[model samples]
Target chain A: AQSVSQHNHHVILSEAASLELGCNYSYGGTVNLFWYVQYPGQHLQLLLKYFSGDPLVKGIKGFEAEFIKSKFSFNLRKPSVQWSDTAEYFCAVNARAGNMLTFGGGTRLMVKP
Target chain B: DVKVTQSSRYLVKRTGEKVFLECVQDMDHENMFWYRQDPGLGLRLIYFSYDVKMKEKGDIPEGYSVSREKKERFSLILESASTNQTSMYLCASRIRDRSYGYTFGSGTRLTVV
Candidate 1:
């Protein structure tokens, strides 16, 4: 079975701090990777996705993720984060021929101003 | 933008009562998914439908049933609500192609007491 692991459970940072949330998947086949963010009282929104092209994929809000096939990792990164960026982040993986997705435990990010 | 809409933002149900959570998407997507969000468990898929009347069991589908009689509407049903089932239910829609990311609903927070 394919599973996703997020290294951090909770991350606290000050405004303008660099951020990196680690994510790793356990699928050996071709897989699609995604980072989704859930703000307080809001739905989960797609932050970034990696399908097939370049390993480094940039997404909304200046966020980006790199898909390293050898490591089975697709870590989300941002140069600077704002107070508004405080939210829960989830990493998900869906392999080829797989009908559903496997999600990580999620990381709660708290940005202090 | 594609919009996936869940019917209720919050719901309180009694134990053993039958509960129905509704979801609708306007993007004419071919795939719809139902997931439950818990504090430490992230999002666990309950069920998914690839087409009308086609349902597939996900990671956790013990006490849940689903209906997809219409292409745009997918409904999650709890045979008997339980306290353990108290969580936020999210609905999402995606096209058949893997290139498109999923669009999620605002979610329904169901509290079974």
Candidate 2:
């Protein structure tokens, strides 16, 4: 079974601060990676994904993630964050052959205005 | 726009009561999933269906059952609700080929008293 681990449980940042959320997975096989964000009173929406291509992938809202296969990591990063970035972020992994996704414990990011 | 719709945004039920949560998708997705979200726990998969009437137990399916008689609809049932089961329930759908990420519903917050 594949499992995802997000070391950070909570993150607090000021406006315009740079942000990075760590995500690691334990799966030996080929996998698809994803980052989803859930804002207050909203549904989970895709942030970005890495299947096959360049290691770095850009997502909506000035966010991006880099898939480091050697380290089994796909960390989410942003050059600068805004107050609207306050939300719960999840990291998920899906094995190439399977349709199921295993999600991390999630990181609650609170950006202070 | 394509969407995954959860029937209710909030639900309250007593312990030992049979509770039903409905989900519908307009994207004609072949795969649907049920997940429960708790603080710090992120999202845990409860059940998933690949096609109509084909259900698969996910990571945590002990207290839950699911019905998928129609391709666009997936229902989660709690045989006997408990306070421990109080959490936000999310529904998601995706196409079969893994070309894209899942589309999630707004979620149903269920409180079992």
Name the weakest run of 10 consecutive residues (lDDT summed) in model 1 chain B. Answer: B94-103
TM-score of chain B of each: 0.98, 0.98
- List TM-score per model, in order: 0.98, 0.98
* Model 2: per-residue Cα lDDT at residue A58: 99
True contacts kept of 2: 0.79
Judge candidate 2 against the unseen true structure and give its global Cα lDDT, from 0 to 1.
0.96
Clashes of 1: 0
Residue A107 CA displacement from its true place in model 2, Å: 0.6
lDDT of 1 by residue, B1-113 (tens): 99999999999999999999999999899999999999888999999999999999999999999999999999999999999999999999999986567899999999999
* lDDT per residue as tens, model 2, B87-107: 999999999977579999999
Quality of candidate 1's docking, in CAPRI categories? medium
lDDT of every model, 2 decimals: 0.95, 0.96
